[model samples]
Target: MVRGRDVILEALENLNEDEFKRFKHRLGTQPLRKGFSSIPRGTLHSLDRLDLTDKIVCYYLEDYGMELTAEVLRAIGMLEEAVRLQQAAGQV
Candidate 1:
C-alpha cells in the first residue's frame, strides 16, 4: 500500500499550476484559528479540491505560520525548499 506521503505527493503532482496558485493565494490571506480543530468552511473546501488529505491539511494548518506555497514544498518532500521558505519567514 502506498504511504500517506506518497498519496499526498501523487495528488499534488496532479494539481494544475493555476489552481494551486489561486489556492496558495487564498490560504495566505485567510486567518486560521489556533489548533486547527476546525477552519473556515471555504478553506476546508479549497483544501478538499486540492486533494489534500486531512493529515496533510492539518499539518499545514498547524504550521500555518509558513506560507502555503512553502508548506506545499514541504508536503511534497521538498525539504530544502521548505527550509528556505521557513528561513525567509523568520521561522528558522
Candidate 2:
C-alpha cells in the first residue's frame, strides 16, 4: 500500500516553485478554529518540500495530513492535484 506521507510528498513534488509557494501561503494563513490549526509563518518559511511534508504528517498524521494537503491544493487552484491526492488517500 502507498503510504499517505508518500502520496503527499508526490503531490508536493508535482508542484512547481510558484504552486508550492501558493500552497505554503494558504497553509500558513489558514485561520485556527476547531480541528484546523495553521502552521506559523516562521515554521513554514524555511521548509523545503520534504520538510513541509514531514511537518504536515507530524502535525496532523496521515489521514488529516492528506486531507489538509488536498484542501490547500484546491485553494491554490491545483484542483487536479487535489483530486489525485484524495484518490490516493482513499478519500475518493
- Tell me, by lDDT, which candidate is best: 2
Residue clash pairs of candidate 1? none
User: RMSD to the native, candidate 2?
Assistant: 1.9
Error of 2 at 44 (Å): 0.3
Candidate 1: list runs displaced more than 4 Å. Answer: 29-34, 37-92
- Number of the top-ranking candidate, with TM-score as the measure: 2
**Least accurate stretch of 10 residues (summed lDDT) in model 2?**
30-39
Candidate 1 per-residue lDDT, tens place, 1-92, comes to: 33334434443454566655554554455544565443455554556443454544455632353455455555555666556555544522
1-92: candidate 2 lDDT, tens digit per residue = 68999999999999999999888989987654377567778999789999999999888888888988888899899999999999889832
Name the weakest run of 10 consecutive residues (lDDT summed) in model 1.
Answer: 1-10
| Regions more than 4 Å wrong, model 2 | 32-36
RMSD per candidate (Å) reads: 12.5, 1.9
